[model samples]
Target: MSEKPINDLSPVVIALALLIIGAEAVFQLANAGLVGGPRGVGWRMEGIGMFGYSPAVLERVLVQHDFSPDILWRFVTYPFINVEIVQAAFCAALTLALGKFTSEYFGGLKVLAIYFMTAIVGAVIYGLLVEGNAPLLGGFTPVYGLIGAYTYVLWLRLGQAGENQLRAFQLIGFLLALQLLFGLIFGGGQSWIAELSGFAAGLALAIPLAPGGWALLLHRLRERS
Candidate 1:
């Protein structure tokens, strides 16, 4: 029997999962005084301050044309910082699941690129669209990108199998519904802008990032003409 696709995790996926989970682990341990020094209690907050994405910084650089490495790095670095362990755990689990299946088709480097590229797009859209004081942090935005890729893959598979391609969107649909419920209950913030944008960007990226994606795009274009 064939093994489940989730078992086919790639190096990039494993690395990404480890980075998110490991960072949270360190933060949790520090809070419990099991690791780091006496100052470890503040490690989580410090990490957020240092690594989290600040829209204020992005706006300042964009308006003033002063793009510094420190400010720019937040686009990618923010995904590594999570405010809580539960959030980190969910993000990491999604990364592993989606990354593994997507990697089976897109390869490890492409999978890595999807994560970074979607993250940047998400942050850019978030910065441009939302007006808030809180700096954005966490991997959900990029993991949502992976969800886009996973959905695209499922779409293609369903299409080839003569099944309902719309079914591919069920995962994202459920997730969005869950997010909506949480937002209604907990009063969520503008982070949804980043995540939703990431998913859209990821869906678009599937065209170029997938193997022979550009060629296929050109072929379709030629057919339409």
Candidate 2:
């Protein structure tokens, strides 16, 4: 594969990703210290104290600290909540993969905007649909955003000739199947719901961004010709 642009690995996005991961690590360390340790962290997960990443708590803190609620709702702080190493790793990897492709086609800023925006959408949908007080933790939201980005890419690629079209359709089918299988095995909840939302967002964003997407306008012009 050809090399992606520098902005795909842009310092701003990379630094932002690292800073979020670092903040989560620090928060976990502090939580462990005040509580006990890893075992204490487990207890915290079990609801021993002001433990776990709570959107409610985060929202409250943002307001108290004078941050705009709109900013908070935009998932600016959501990335900071994934303290687990595996979760953070998954998020970073997915971000790089999806960001590279998205930045390649749509530009870095647009990719970033889509990722964050869809992440917030996923989390908000989860918060509204799931039962009361079920904390929406983990980087799955943004990770799903990356999945969304890939889906959008596939959709656009489908509009191309030959193998690209076949590959695009194949990928979409695979993604849908994966979602269904996972939902069947684990039962529908936040992860599944978020994944669906991410897919939807990706498709929606891709519609306007794809080259062939505007072909309809050209087609109308040709008709008038």
Each model's lDDT comes to 0.88, 0.60
TM-score for each of the candidates: 0.91, 0.66
Q: How far off is residue 143 in model 1, in Å?
A: 0.7
lDDT of 2 at 2: 86
lDDT (Cα, tens digit) per residue for candidate 1, span 34-119 = 99889999999989887788678678779988778877888898998998988999999989988888899899999899999999
Candidate 2: regions farther than 4 A off: 1-8, 27-74, 164-166, 169-189, 210-225
Which residue runs of candidate 1 sit more than 4 Å off their true CA positions? 1-6, 217-225
lDDT of 2 by residue, 28-56 (tens): 66566764565655542443123333345
Clash totals for all models, in order?
Answer: 0, 0
Please provide the root mean square deviation of candidate 2 (C-alpha atoms, Å).
6.0
Candidate 1 lDDT score at position 62: 91
User: Best candidate, TM-score-wise?
Assistant: 1
After best superposition, candidate 1 residue 55: deviation in angstroms? 1.3
Clashing pairs in 2: none
